[model samples]
Target: MYGGADGAVAVLSVAEEQKHLLAYAPLVKRIVRQLNSQVAGAIDRDDMEQIGLMGLLEALRRYGEPDAAFGSFASLRVRGAILDELRRQDWRPRAVRQESHRLRDSVRALTRKLGREPAEKEIIAALGITAEAYQEYQLAENAEQIGSFDELLQEGMGQADSAPSPEEQLMVRRSLEQALRGLDEREQRVVQMYYEFELSYKEIAAVLDLTDARVCQLNKGALGKMKATLQSA
Candidate 1:
């Protein structure tokens, strides 16, 4: 679909950039593939790849010295670009969000009516929705919860424009530390594996012998606790 002269220039630019990047196109592809799977069939893999390549170019420009850390630095920027695009896509349409709200409202009403939490059967009967549909609703909410938490984590990991003063930096790290302590042992491990080690949820699930869904749930719970702590701070 690329036209004549502009297309040639783009191709040449990418070729030149890749040379300076030390041929890190594989890293971009890996990140895009991993993220595409989690997007639930929303974004086209090719489009994400293009965004990732642009990110790598930006990384190389910003990173004047291609030292030992260039690979790590470029990887973060590439992944960040793809993640930002995913958020912008907001694959969950307005209809899906409205439906999620309705589902939560129904569950709340059922719990209040029962004087306690309602069982799955009770919920299905009251809402007249299939179990699979209910699961879809839960999945939507869980995805959003973890996505927000990732945005917070990404910013904390040096994505800011202006560097904070020493005191401010210490305070921010302390806030994160306090927020992390609110998690359980396993949840702490999950956070470390994610933010420290930069492992995917699927990878974490394999290491912990838990399903991806279980890992997401743990992160979602941690997000709730951390957000409350941050708000109160």
Candidate 2:
């Protein structure tokens, strides 16, 4: 449909865009690697990398120079795209979802009855589960909740329709800061390093002299508490 000069310009434009995408390839890989650490074994790294590449392409199409730095913006887009894919997969078993709901309901009921957060033993006794079973439930619930929180963060980062206005964003930041204060020193530090400092789990573990799994546990607990606080606020 184009004349010779117009066709040549279109070809050159496509070539330039391809070159830009190639330039950002390493960034995509890094993001995939970082997110893959958290969800290892849940999804294949190669698949996640493919999702990240799609994200990078989306970023290239939508990004404007006056926005944030390209690397940071692109990273957020990549992470969001990967997380969106995970959400689409809905890999959690239906039974697991039902159990998580029951556990949440029990917690809410116990809190209402006691007028405070129930202790671990109290919850276990209320649920009529052995300590070992309760621990398993906690671990599963933590993983599920952390996944939800990650989705929340990803949505906040990338979705324009879901994004908060500046005033609302400031309010959320303040509320989150207040909620973080409710955590112990170590929990607060773990959250700050992981989210604010953008440190990987292993990196955070090394800095805090803890194992990777321990860091994950702490992060899960912190997010649970933060979510509760934010919801109450």
Candidate 3:
């Protein structure tokens, strides 16, 4: 029994990389959905899925740090991989791209006009899309678009990096680090996984021995807390 147990451990160790990639497939899908929401063009969900898979593969191949959760690390890789593909597609027609931009503008304008989130119907009407053609046009226009990496990376950097002097920058860094320390361990882990390490919730849950719901709750609560703290500070 001891020998068999040892043999099983060896097998599992060898298969860990494959296991990691398989484990985070669902996370890729969720991220893709998020990307879809942000972009305009024929950016099909399937295309994002494929890109995510490629990213997962790369992450698996390059995975380091056994102490870190695989999902957390792979999230960034998957997102980056998906975006890289979008950037490479130089063959997207000019008219289609233009229309996509216009559609986004329309959506934005309607949102402001209504003082709330606009529905698909409102977007279609604003874009002059016919009922019969709206679905097709929307799908096509969104297929080429995915989430932008720049926005994700720069979200809080502007405020944090605006310090005028080296001493001020150091002070800001220390302050941010101190603020981060006040979060609960789970919140710290979630934030690290999602932003710093780039793990998906699914992956973080697996590594942390928690459910997906709990991971999300902790993340959301942590963000809300952080935002409130920042605002008050």
lDDT of each: 0.70, 0.69, 0.59
- Give the backbone clash total of model 3: 16
Each prediction's RMSD to truth = 8.2, 7.2, 12.8
**For candidate 3, lDDT tens digit of each residue in 127-221?**
77875455445444434422322223223334311112334335545655665677998788877776555565557879999755456556655
TM-score of each: 0.65, 0.62, 0.40
Q: Number of clashes in model 1?
A: 0
Q: Which candidate leads in TM-score?
A: 1
Model 3 scores worst on lDDT over the 10 consecutive residues at 1-10
Ranking by lDDT: 1, 2, 3
User: After aligning candidate 2 to the native by TM-score, how far in Å is the CA of 226 from where it should be?
Assistant: 7.0
Question: Which residue pairs overlap in candidate 2's backbone?
Answer: none
Question: By lDDT, who's the top model here?
Answer: 1
Candidate 2 ranges with C-alpha deviation above 4 Å: 1-23, 37-40, 64-68, 128-136, 142-184, 197-233
* Residue range 1-233, candidate 2, lDDT tens digits: 11243222122355665887788888777767666666545688898888888887766665522133456556667777887887688866789778878987988899999999887779889989877666556555555544455554444344432223345556656877888899999999998887656677888989999767567668888887987887787
lDDT (Cα, tens digit) per residue for candidate 1, span 23-59: 7888887777666656676778898899988888877
Overall local distance difference test of candidate 1: 0.70
lDDT of 3: 0.59
**Where does candidate 1 clash, by residue pair?**
none
- lDDT of candidate 2 at residue 46, scale 0 to 100: 90
